[model samples]
Target chain A: MPKVTIDGHEIEVSQGTTIMQATKQLAIEVPYYCWHPGLSVAGNCRMCLVDVEGPPKPQIACYTQVTEGMVVHTQSEKAKKARKGTLEFLLSNHPLDCPVCDQAGECDLQNFYMDHGQYDSRFDEQKHKKKKAQPVGENVMLDQERCVLCSRCVRFCDEITGTGELGIVNRGSHEEITVFPGKEVNNAYSGNVVDICPVGALTDRDFRFKCRVWYLSSQDSVCPGCSQGCNIRIDSNLSRPQHGEGERVMRLKPRENLNVNDYWMCDEGRYNYNFIDRNRIQTASRVKEGVVEEILFEDAVDSLASVLGDAVREQRHGRIGVLVSTQLTNEDLFFVKKFFKTNLGMDAVESRFSFPEGSSDDFLIKADKSPNTAGAQALEVIASGTYQSGEDLIDKTIAGEFDVLISFGVDIDGLLGKEKLDAILEKVTLLAYVGSNHNETSKKAQLVIPSTVYAEKDGTFTNVHGRVQRIWPAFPPLGQARPEWQIICDLSEKTGFSVSADDAESIFSEITQTVSSFQGLSYEKLGKEGSLLSTVKETVEK
Target chain B: MEIPEELKKKWDEAVARYEEKRAALLPVLRLSQDHFGYISAEVEEAVAHYMGTTPVHIREVVTFYELFHTKPVGKNNIQFCHTLACNLNGCEPLIKQLKEKIGIKEGETSSDGKYSFSRAECLGACEMAPMMKINKDIYGPLDKDKLNEIIENL
Candidate 1:
């Protein structure tokens, strides 16, 4: 180990650690643009210049390694001058389009300029021009006039995904980032370039000019698009509903979690968050005779409990079928198991209702689209270990095996066409749906209850690798929607099997007690990056 | 684009001379420019494919140097030195004279495809200052009559 002092703070690091890494240990701020921890060092962006005791001039902190008894000063006058000069040259060609730029608030260039910039402009020359608003990929927009040529996006494509689609063409003042003449950057992780670009050069096409980032509030959550369980921060528009056409969620940014997705996520998960606010079932409703009447959530749950409680009390467990979707979180799944399987002893309870598999790669996207298949499997709710049992549930319902049926977040029409779903609706006397989004199943169910999506609830999800991670809500449930566990608890009390846990944390504690895989785990222990299941931990230790 | 057998042999020798394939990019580009009149986009793509790299990477190198022309050159390619040595030796007046006679400026070719004009950094002949190269021949230290006579015969 080598001991180095950075700005009067001393720390010991490994032999090959850089000065920037040492500054990070001491909580010293060294501004940078091209030095991403996940990407290789380009050393072109001179924003991280720092003064060393031995070097004649300021050295770049990102590439200069520390030695024994080395003294470095990140806030020295020489280092500050170097940084000011670098920023001045970088902004010499920058078109001051801050008022219309989408990355005005969260851009590092703007943030660093406010912290360490020399405000007065010495440049009176006309700024160089390049192409603007070029769609480089399906989800990424490129503005060449604002680029500082850090080469982070070019290096990201070259080293990370191994898809060398971007490069800096020409030289000097005429240089700009571009793909081939006719080709485009259409990789599986293309949206991440917009996240890694330090300036407004690359912006998300889906989120461009939708709403200003300062008006949006963010919360940590997990992406429910697949079993990969990539950690994310959900940004919602709470104050202004007129910005994104009355949409609540503004965007989803990938949170750094080394255990799961590191710092990158697939485009499939990044752009699939509109379902949280679009086409949602705003209020509970019941189908009376042939027309649907809007009702309160209390009336819908009470009427459902009366019919299901009667069926279970008459020893007609064989006639009641409960189909749960794997999209429910672990806390939600635990309550579902407690109310339906434990109290009623229903034999036809299934959670692995199948849907169409999505396109996957060896990187982040998973073939199983649901985020909590492993959670359902760990709780012993999904018996077959496969997500292809929706056909079986539909077949049983069509054959008149069950007089009552309830499902959560399952689209039966999408799984087996509208004809089979119509058949099940005709046979079952009472078809109830407890989900967030509106679909054919929600439209046809006799009783419909609105529930919160993953972004609007606090819970944990066990990923495909058996790591249980936590998710916090970005906002309250939309309109009159409630968390699924709260709905289940209300139904349990009305059905003569009342449970005690009220919040998501207490319900997860109950899960840790009952499920063998989730033993000795709590929300405090799960933290941001999750904890692997006990069974997985034992196997990994071996 | 099919590379000729002799050019492929030269490319193999160039790759073997360097430890890495990409280190041989300059020599390979030079060979392509000598065989083909100018390095077009097709030739750049062919050279990049032969070197196991990308066309954008090759395009960056092609645009950096003044000698590597990207478009087809004329029958006579004329280059006038424009660095400190030539500027001190009264090369600007001679260059201006040639530009008016050629009916084109720097970085432009003649309309009849008979002449092309450009400014070079240094030709490594500072002793023969105020020099200009035309079709692999160098002429310098001349008066206005000698310069006009040389172009008139061509």
Candidate 2:
């Protein structure tokens, strides 16, 4: 270990660490471009210039090596002047286009300019002009004028995704980035280039100019897109109404969960927040016949238990099947199984939906697509593990063994198709549903209990690889809708089991002790930065 | 290796700077630009590859900084510093005059490429408002005839 003093702070770092690393270790930030922690070091920008005692001139801390006990000062007059000059030069021809640049508030160039740039410009000359608003890829629109040309995005494509789609073409002033003739930036991780581009040179076509980033607020939560359970932040405007309800979700962005998704989310998850808009069904209620009756909290539980009890004792297995969807949280499934299996003693607990409703691209999305199947099953919830397809589960429900059936599902109807799943739901005596969307499944259910979307509820989920992770709620549940645990807890108390209030931690603890896989785990230790719990089993990327 | 005297002079100057290899860039580029007039593709590639930054990275300083010209400039780079003070005054009308006299638009050189026209931002000479730099020379409070005379001389 080598110890060094940076700006009067003494710190020890491992060998092969640069002076830049030492400053970073001490949290004494030095401005830099062309050096991303995830990418290989390219000490080009000259922005992170630092002063060392032995070395006469300011050295780039990124590439400069740190020796034992060598003094370094990043705040010297010489260093400051050098940095200021560099910034002035960098800003000379740069179009003051921050008003329109998407990276305005978060841009490093803007920040560095304010921090280290000279107040007075040096150039008395006309600015060089370049083409603007060039479409670089399917999802990205590039502005060549705004490009700093750090090549982080290009390098990310080449090295990270192994898809070398973008390159800096031409040379010097005439240089611009473009895709190879026939090749486009149409990779699974292509949207991330927009995120990595330090300037507004690259902007996502989907998110471009919809709303400035400053207006939308973000919440750290897990992605409910797939069983991968990549942690994410839900950016929304709470004051704005949903369908004029005064609160709505605008977009989904990847939160930094290093273990799951390190600041990158698949395009599917990023753009999938559209359905949660006001037009979508968020409130819970059951529709009987042609008349829709919205029942109170206690009544919903009693009605469901009574309905399932009637089906289980007097009726048969196929008639009174329980279809639990993958989008459901562990708490919902826990109480779901408790209400049916413990109280009614029903055997049907299988997922209502599986993965890949569309084409399966070989990337983050998996074929077995439910977000929380493993968690539901880990609780001894009666789930048909082998019966993978949503249509298959619906087919078994329509086989006529039982009369009344219930489903806890969302986004499942599309996979089974409307007519196919509806034909199966039509055979049942009573179809009760707890879902976020009022699609075919919920419509078929004689009683519908409006469920909260993943963003609106706080719950724990078991991803595909059996890693139990907790998801924090970004927004409050929609009006009259409730978390699955609360709904099921109400049902459990009415039906039979000793049920607690809607406290996820208590339920998780109860599950953890009994379930051998999750022996000594607690929500407190499930990695705010991610630690490998023994029971996590295997790391699933997709 | 036989290095040009001018190149060696640049090298010596870059070495004289406190930070040798790092400071070598600006001087080297300026010398190369003097020899080559414009920083051509081959020169940019060699400089970037030698400097360990990509051509794209080096291009930022070359284009953004007023001094470095990625393209060939005329014998004289006619500049009107468009800083706060200059823009406040009637630089627009003055630009119109210069444009007409030069017989080429701002940012364009003559057909022979003897004179290039460009409007620069603040050159840190606020007191000398409406100042312009022709290569390394400074001219301020410029008018139509002064601009024409300067262009004609160039």
- lDDT digits (tens) for residues A1-542 of candidate 2: 88899989999899999988788778898988777777878786688888888867888888988889978888999889889987876677688899988778878888888888848776898877887877767788888777776788878876778766677765565566666544578877778888778778888887776666767778777777776777777878765443224436666777676566667788777777765655445545666667877777567767877765555556554356677776877767777776666666666666645455543455556555567767765665654445555456667666665466666764346665677666666677777777777676675566777778888776677766666777777777776677777877777666566666648777767766766776787888775543333566555544
Residues B11-71 of candidate 1: C-alpha lDDT, one tens digit per residue? 8999999999999999999899889988998898899789877777788788887778899
Tens-place lDDT digits, model 1, residues A1-542: 99999999889999999999899888899999999998999899999999999979999999999999999999999998899899988889999899999999998889888888947998888888899999998999999998989999888888878787788987788889988777788888998899999999999999999999999998999999999999998998989889999888888999998778889999889999888988999899999989999998899999999988888779886787778888899988888888787787876778866567889887788989999999998997752322246568668789887788888878787778899889988898888999999999999999999999999899999898999999998888988899889998899889888765769999999888878889999999999888999988533210
Candidate 1 pairs with clashing backbones: none
Evaluated at residue A273, the lDDT of candidate 2 is 78
Off by over 4 Å in 1: A383-388, A538-542, B135-137
lDDT of 2 by residue, B1-154 (tens): 2446766677567657856565577777887788878876667666766666555545545664567777788887888888789878657888888778778987898988778989887887767666788888888777667767766776
CAPRI class of candidate 1? medium
True interface contacts retained by model 1: 0.50
Candidate with top lDDT is 1
Sorted into a CAPRI-style docking class, model 2 comes out as incorrect
* Lowest summed lDDT window (length 10), candidate 2 chain B: B52-61
